[model samples]
Structure formats: C-alpha cells, structure tokens
Target: AGGQGEGNGLTQLPCPLGLVVDQLGTIYVTDDGNHRIMRWPKGATQGSVIVGGNGGGGQSNQLNGPVGLSFDRHDCDHCEENTDWVLASEPLSHSFQTVKLTHHLLWTVDTNQ
Candidate 1:
C-alpha cells in the first residue's frame, strides 16, 4: 500500500542483502548499502535499526557491509533460556557475528576470525 524510494525510512532501503522473519512475524533486513540491520514490525510503514546503522566500524554496536542473516536454532551451551541468536555475516569486513536478541548484544564469533 506504499512506494519504495530514496529516503530515511522503510521506503528507503538501499542494497538490502539479507532478510529473515522471526517466530512472531517480525521482519529483519540487512541494509547493506546503509551498513545497518533494520527491523520491521509486521505491517509497519518504517523500520528501526536493531544494530549497526551508526556508520561502519569494528565497534561492538556497528556493522559494515552486512550480507547475510539467520537464526541459530541449535541447542548450544552458549544459548541461554532457549533464546535463538541471530547470526550476521559482514563480508566486506570479513566478519561473522551472533546477536543475542534478548539483550540486543552483538558477539564476534565468526569462524573466519
């Protein structure tokens, strides 16, 4: 029910490389061109940055060239309280990381590192 274009909102997604849907119908996107991860609530008009989106850097909260994403469903000791972690791959930085949704924290656990 809307148009997508160049702006600072849901309509403005540049080079979005990855997409995923959660158990509750939330949509997650890796806005590669913008160097950020965006979260769109079901039927929402705009998306909010869950991670990155603060320019590119190696900081704990920044992401550069995020390319892929997935939910970690395996039952591992690192997962607490049955929470699924979101894994993101930033190819340009040669990095892969896991984000803990419960605490909204990003961890650098890329095998390439």
Candidate 2:
C-alpha cells in the first residue's frame, strides 16, 4: 500500500513484509525497514506506530526488522523480529510483552492468567 520511500508516515512504507486485518477493519503492518509496527484504522489517511519505532536494536523497546505478525485470542499482536525474540503488544493499551525463543519454536505464555 506504500510506494513512497522508506518513511514512518502513514502512506510511506519502507519495507512492509507482513500484515493482518482485525475484525474492526484496522490494518496492522510489520514495517521491517522502519523496525516498527503500524496501525492503520479503516478509512484513515495515516497510520500510527503501535510498537517499536524507537530505532533498530536489541533493546527491550526496540525492534530490528520485524518480519511476521499474528494476533492472539486476547487481541494482542505477536510479532517475530529478525532476532531470537518475539514481541507482543496490545494496540489499545500500548503495552509490550516480550518472549525469547529457543530452537526457533513459537509459543505463547499468558502471564496474565
């Protein structure tokens, strides 16, 4: 959906590799080039960063080229970064939960329960 040069603007996507549409028609995209996840509300002209966007690194608050995304039953987005960690975020709450992986296995542990 973006042809412009790599940018954080709603219409500019540097290297979007994965996307998912929620039941509310809100689109979530994995902005790999920008190292962030973007949330674009249906019919909106711009999207906001729901996760990452703090530059690429190994920091807890940063993402380096996220490539895949999915949503769990609780509406939390799970993203697989270009590292050994998986990042989860609730767009509405703007909170983050990170999990490290071993042997490239993907699993969810609901700490809230």
Output the number of the lDDT-best candidate: 2
Weakest lDDT window of 10 consecutive positions for candidate 1: 74-83
lDDT per residue (tens digit) for residues 50-78 in model 2: 77888998777788899888877788888
Please identify model 1 stretches exceeding 4 Å from their true place.
1-3, 74-113
What's the TM-score of every candidate structure? Answer: 0.59, 0.79
Clashes of 2: 0
In candidate 1 the C-alpha lDDT for residue 20 amounts to 67
On residues 2-110, what C-alpha lDDT tens digit does candidate 1 reach at each position?
1486544655786777776765576777777666777777888877776666675545566657766655443111211112345454422435465645554434253
Off by over 4 Å in 2: 92-94, 107-113
Query: Could you tell me which 10 consecutive residues in candidate 2 have the lowest summed lDDT?
Result: 104-113
Find the candidate with the highest TM-score and give its number: 2
